[model samples]
Target: MKVFYYLKHIGLALLPHSWFTRRQRKLEQKFADQQDYIQRRVDYYLKTAQPFTLAPEETTAIADYTRRGFTSYFYDLKEYLHYFPKQCRFAYYFGDETHIEPRHTLFKARPIAGDNERSVIFKLDKRRHFRFVEDTLSFAEKKPMAVFRGAVTQPHRIRFMETLFGHPLVDAGQSNPSETHPEWQQPFMSVEDQLQYKFLFALEGNDVASNLKWAMSSNSLVFTPKMVFETWFMEGTLQAGVHYVEVKDDFSDVEEKINYYLAHPEKAQQIIDNAHAYLAPYQNPDLEDLVCIKVLERYFSLSGQLEK
Candidate 1:
């Protein structure tokens, strides 16, 4: 798929230079259409025009970016930069630290709200974080219990995993082995394995829950507390009960929420449907390219780079 994206980008480069510029102009107008879904997302991601500039030495050419992190970040960003010179400058971050706030850099995670202006989001590490599953099991066919399998490295998840790790209604366990809690260690379960259950946990780890995009795409109902971190998925826009069953930060309400949904399959199915609808737009590769291009254009325009 990455090769196909590269070939398509090379194909686009053969078109007249004006074609790319015109495409960007049309998309900028699309971002202005207040009623458009794409516009709403663009607005949320890049709320205000943050005018800034970078010294030549401070900027790293996108091609020259170190590939120590996921090489997938390079592929995702460069796919949209075929029109620009290889030396075009960009700043980026590719790590688990959620506090990353560069003046203008491509980053994976950002706060859902408050003190977020310095961060500019792009779909970095998309293959890992945003990959969706093809869940065929229906909400009714799956078991009533919820399942969770991940490292207990995040502060938010420690208590939940400790308290409910052995609960009868859940199959929760730590996948990453820990010397402190060797008893809770279990083999990793694929997204498909978790799909067998009617409720899937989308607990936040370093930033946003890495399993969230795929979990929401599945047939099972997702159980999560309120989201504090967001990526390209717009976690803040998700309403409790409509997209997923909201649980208390503690596992205080997990069983109650899961039992309610088990009894009301219709309500569970509705949340699954809403989740699929939310994820539908992101499935398109062309739309992804266009949105990324619009974002890059804004970064360049506001930073005084496009003027050159």
Candidate 2:
């Protein structure tokens, strides 16, 4: 069965990574052009509204680099083609920055079937220059939503499932050790869930000094988002205590930032003010600011600031 399914979907499965193909190149060009267009539009807007002087090259670079990240999602979706009875739907979305490491599983599902529905969800974490996964959920037309309770993020977990079901692999979701194994009772939380924010916020506020220290220690691990909208400003590093706060060059840490700002409006304002000036020279300042602001708003809502 696995062999049969592999043979069936191999063609579409072999689509090249987004960076190498002609159509992607064309899409990349389109994105580049759009950035240029937006920058000019923004320049016009800013020029009329405020007295600002920006380097053309800086604006172009900012626009070009940021657009590349934002457009990749659109390009990926645009390039998606139906493999007949195997239409691919996003079950989880992750930017290329997120490494889709292999995991072993005990439950098996057909990959062809998965292409149609089973998917994982991840958001691009610009601050970390990677995608921090929110959650991995399974899809079935009739079902509400099912959690993929596996033991870990590994290929063996998926393979275990494949063997269990005797079917070719398609896709998977996150697993909970407590549910899967009796000896292990680890609490599982999806990044998509609201609790993650609360937890992180507590971690940050609970021991500001320690948290800052830890953040600094792990500064090198952070990756800024490739997009202009991200707030991961590449500002080097800050030493708050024994540990330093890993300063991002951009603002991709949208969620954390909103929370931080809400909690410490002064600091947040400082960031917003600085970003306004620092990113002024880069491309599409308005659009980039808009994205970051929107992300902040969403976080506000999630934090119960807005009524749904």
lDDT of 2 at 94: 34
lDDT of 2 by residue, 67-153 (tens): 234443432222222211121111223343222222210011112111211112212232232222212221111121111233443
Which regions of candidate 2 are displaced past 4 Å?
Answer: 1-34, 37-174, 178-196, 199-308
Residue 162's lDDT in candidate 2:
35
TM-score for each prediction?
A: 0.87, 0.20
Q: Quantify all predictions' global Cα lDDT against the true fold.
A: 0.79, 0.28
Q: Write the per-residue lDDT of candidate 1 for residues 1-308, one digit (tens) a residue.
A: 87986686568757776777787667556646533666566666666666787667767875575547567776677666755555668777777656755566667888887878667777777878878889988988999899999889777788878879889999989988778789888887877789999999999888888999999999999999888988888888899989888898877988888778878899899999999998998998657767777677667767776753
Model 1, residue 59: C-alpha shift (Å): 1.9
Candidate 1 has what TM-score? 0.87
Error of 1 at 134 (Å): 2.0
Model 2 residue 304 CA deviation (Å) reads 53
